[model samples]
Target: MLENTQISILGCGWLGFPLAKHFIAEKSTVKGSTTSADKVADLKNAGIQPYVFTLGANNNADVYRNFVAESDVLIINFPPKRVEHIETLYPAQIQEIASHIRFRQKVIFISSTSVYQNTNDWVTEDLVNQPEKASGKAILAAENILREKLQNRLTILRFAGLFGYDRAPGRFLANKKELSSANAPINMIHQDDCIRLISAVIRKNVWGEIINGCADVHPIRKRFYILAAKKLGLQPPEFKEETTVSFKKISNLKSKMLLQSTYKYPNPLVFVL
Candidate 1:
């Protein structure tokens, strides 16, 4: 149980903030970090010990060192920025964070499904495919770095395309035109599921493993986006017809088996919020 445990969240935005709140509600102490100073007050108001911490900008090294050192569980939750040489740069960033850890603290690295490319079939934690996109390649590199540093007490959760509440998929391609991959299936998971999956990881004590968090149903990209747009009263986007389908359906069997997770929004087609 998380009762009376100290947990640290490295990137306390969106998913991290909510996860911190969840920890607090469980009677666990939480330490949260943000790159923005504005969010520090918000985190403090919610009873989280907040630190205005930024990677590579090491103006105050002691602040981050204490943030990493104090916690029994550390959740590293951040995405790589789209910058030049991200493949090299992102791993360097992870390497910096990994340096601070006290050897064997339980660490959860919030990774992405982008680590796997479109293989036109099912992609599980077992399959390792070189991602096609620049960002994906960067994340993959970052994952390997973390694995090397905290292999003993680490759990890497690779979530699918995140969408829910304010982050509506309808807003993504609502007014776009001539988008490709119409026939391709969309792999996505909602915000609620992401949070629950993280909690499941801690409760089950599933460490030193890699798990894929996603829905079971894979919906066609064109159809899901159209419904998502209509649900929000947005102009449905147009897509080019495809002769064949291409996709990498992210399998959640490992998460389900390990975390005992049942997705709240299994099908993205019915997702409005």
Candidate 2:
């Protein structure tokens, strides 16, 4: 679907690099951004046109403008690390991007399911975002900013906790003395599934919609990690807390209905086992 279209990814860290590679595989011109100059060559080696850039604080508006202006589709994948001042800085970064780009270009803003409050219910795009933390509030505000400016040209994909490659659940809990929320339900999406959902969006040209991107399976946190460790021949992790944490389960039905997309890794538990 995106045979020759130029796609630029802002923030080529864990999620961004794989996304850029996916677009390039689809025969699209991929431009990936990294705040560190050291990563520029790595991105280029993967067939991506890399740019050393960072948003927030004293950002260069000119660079942001040029990148957005040049690309047919722009994906904002940067994470706001300073949660203390995210309310002010996050929206400003989105505004910085929106101010530079034309209204005609389609923008895909990669958000997180952390925007949802821990309500212990299935969350859909139709539900209003009620972020409990500063990070979530900032992302919600950024979504609002994009919607207000780009209108129907903006698409929001709210993803669950990410795990893949070297970042498997087993490794996270391996050799741990104590783990919390062992029985709590784990809602996560593999990196491959994330890329698949994004690719489907690009192929379908689905815009002006807020979609939840997550896997189909939800496993109890403790059991999931124990299984993962067992498969790796490692000792199962021990849990300190038996109480469950209130968390929202994400649904991907809207994405499936809209794009007719099939997840490559629907059950993240499979990877752990």
Candidate 3:
């Protein structure tokens, strides 16, 4: 347990909300920021200290400054949304926050496996980043800025496709037709595992490392999504009987090795809502 520790999380949506709750349960002082005013009550109800931290050129800088100043550790949880002109908006937002982060505070930046181009093979943390999409490129750029600004104070977590909770893969592709990458391996992690990894990192004070957060199992997309939909009683998606060269199986060996003896939802295939 982190005693008398203050942790601030930027972006309390999806993954960050649960993570903040976990830390609060462990007796850590947690301050969380949300872009929505409605979510402020939700965060407070979950035992989190909530603030409205909207992103923009004219965002309240004092709110962010106070948040950073009051925390011992900060986790930057805002990911680049796959939207129009996100390639520019994403990095700018991150840069604004990075500039305000106080000195000597430990930082965690949530990244994505999309930073790696489809390598058609197993990839580890050592693999060179070759982003294919705009979101990927934006995230990679934000990561570089954090590394440069925070130096050894930052830890990067490149999460695989996040599923579980309200984001079940079953509904994602249900009834979709002519899907590509039928045989491509599914690299994903349950939300429980995602929370666990982030918790372990903070508790153990693991810093200055780049770790991949994902399940060990790599079931093919067609098989996994079809089974998922069947279990949910939704329409199973159809996929062409073909294999694509654009695919990569992310390995969590580095995370396992670093977090020693910790395991939660290692195989995403067995994950149930």
lDDT (Cα atoms) of all candidates against the true structure = 0.87, 0.84, 0.86
- lDDT tens digits, residues 169-215, model 1? 98999989999999888789988899999988888899999999888
Model 1 whole-model lDDT (C-alpha atoms): 0.87
* Superposition error at 233 for model 2 (Å): 5.8
Residue pairs clashing in model 1 are none
The segments of candidate 1 whose C-alpha lies over 4 angstroms from its true place after superposition are none
Candidate 2 regions exceeding 4 Å error are 57-59, 175-180, 229-236, 241-245
* Candidate number with the higher TM-score (1 or 2): 1
Model 1 residue 92 lDDT score: 79
- Please give the RMSD to the true structure for each candidate, in Å: 1.4, 2.0, 1.5
Q: Candidate 2 — what's its lDDT?
A: 0.84
Candidate 3 lDDT by residue in tens digits, 49-80: 88886777476889889878879899999887
lDDT by residue (tens digit), candidate 2, 221-272: 8888888888778888888875557767888899889989878888887786
